[model samples]
Target: MELRHLRYFVAVAEECHFGRAAARLHVTQSTLSTQVKALEREVGGPVFVRTSRRVELTEAGELLLVEARRTLAQADRALDVARQSVRGETGVVRIGFSGIAVLAGTLAADLHHFHRAHPRVELHVTELPPAAQVQGLRDGTLDIGYSPDNGLGDVGDLVVGRGVRTTLSIAVRHDHSLASAASVAPADLEGENLVVYAADEDDDSVLDRLGAEQRARVHRVTGTLGALVLASAGVGVAVVPAATERVGLPDIVYRPLRDMEADVEVVTLSRPDELGGPVRAFVRSWDRAGRLTQS
Candidate 1:
């Protein structure tokens, strides 16, 4: 009838004596007997046979004892798992990133630090365009994302956890005319083919700022690596975050664009009320890294 009833029944069945079972259970013999009687009544049968000298289990008592032990063990395991989840000791974190964001070290370092600190938590990282990252966050395919700060209009349900200022720059072949300059201006690209990641017309992307004539000369590349490969082959110039310089593409030089800057934001789509320990730790680590960079 109740968990305690099952417990008392099992203890009585194991000890086969009223007084010893009562002592083991820390209950009076009368109380234990009463509970066992309640269980037997609930099951519509006598669970024990009593004699003046001893007590022994009936057929139903043996079967019920086995099931009761299993049920209690399962309950204990369930409680342990729930506590672990609450403490952020185990779970999965799915992270999404835009192409240029991966070129930076933020995504890679964050994953490294998070795993080092919480090894039990599984980390899954996916490369996506900024728009696709936002969509993934909205649809629950992603838990967190590193994407350009374009207001996240379509993903209005997502929250911007933190942001870092990223500078846009041009990647050109070493022999290109502008590669020798310390910095370049947007107008310097007037006649050159520009390779960029594809985006929707309504998106507030850096490419949107280029003039109509510059847009006309632009070519859409499939991915970040492709853009760099194209630039290395002298197909066109590639625009990417200043951090991308660390990617170490040989024969390709990275130069800052004087008039353009990009901002990257970390986004979380879950309800604010559900903020958990792991997510908080991740954001704190990100902010600390950003501060170190500024210093």
Candidate 2:
């Protein structure tokens, strides 16, 4: 009926001796007998048949013993899962990411580090534009985000951590005349249609910065990889973070943007007061990655 009753019944069924069962359970034989008798009455049947030489399980006792072991095992597993969850060893963490911030910044490295450190933590990573990241964080959908400072930095009531700055680079088709050049000046991009990240609702944009000194019209792509692919197909020149070259996609050349120096900062954003243990652990993992980089 109860857990203790099942436990007592299991011990006695295993030992097959009243005295030994009581000793194993750290209880008196009389007490064990009374509990077992109570259990038997509740079940409306005899759980054990006793003879002078030895004790044996009746048909009801045998069936109950098998089910009882399974129930106890399940109960123990449930307790363990609860304890682990409380300790932040296992849970889900929802992370939102902007194109360059996640793929071209340290966010990608930090993700690998976090997964290695907390293998049991489930990571729900979403690739979103800076505006979406802000919205997701503002609502309860996203616990944390790796985003550029342009849109997410000045958002309401969110905690933003200082992040590394990334220099801009020009991505162009491999066969383009200037692709082999050491670096590209903003003048070179003048009159050239440029593929750029989808602009956030905020006015401050990396594309705007890169094209500030030029007359290029911006054609937007939703993600970092998409921007590069469009550039590779000669759709337009793309100004991307230098870190994007780490992927080494073919048919595109990433060259430093010279003459005009524009830098975008990638930062971590989280709910001001709603960050949970799993989310904190994820942030801590990024901190550790930063330390290792500095070291």
Q: Count the backbone clashes (under 3 Å) in each candidate.
A: 0, 0
lDDT of 2: 0.78
Give the distance in Å from residue 127's predicted Cα in candidate 1 to where it truly belongs: 1.7
lDDT of 1 at 151: 35
Least accurate stretch of 10 residues (summed lDDT) in model 2?
Answer: 286-295
**Model 1 lDDT tens row, 1-295:** 6778888888888888989999999999999889888888899999899999888988988898889999988888898876765676677777777666665555676788878988887778887766677677666677677765543455545555444556778899999998999998878888898876554434335566544265766767535777789999999998766666777878999998886444344333332333555555555565665531211
Cα misplacement distance, residue 68 of candidate 1 (Å):
2.6
For model 2, residues 82-112, the per-residue Cα lDDT tens digits are 7776666888999888777755556777778
lDDT (0 to 1) per candidate: 0.71, 0.78
TM-scores for candidates 1 onward, in order:
0.77, 0.75
Regions more than 4 Å wrong, model 1: 14-31, 41-44, 51-55, 154-156, 197-201, 208-213, 220-222, 259-271, 275-295
Q: What is the lDDT of residue 61 in candidate 1?
A: 81
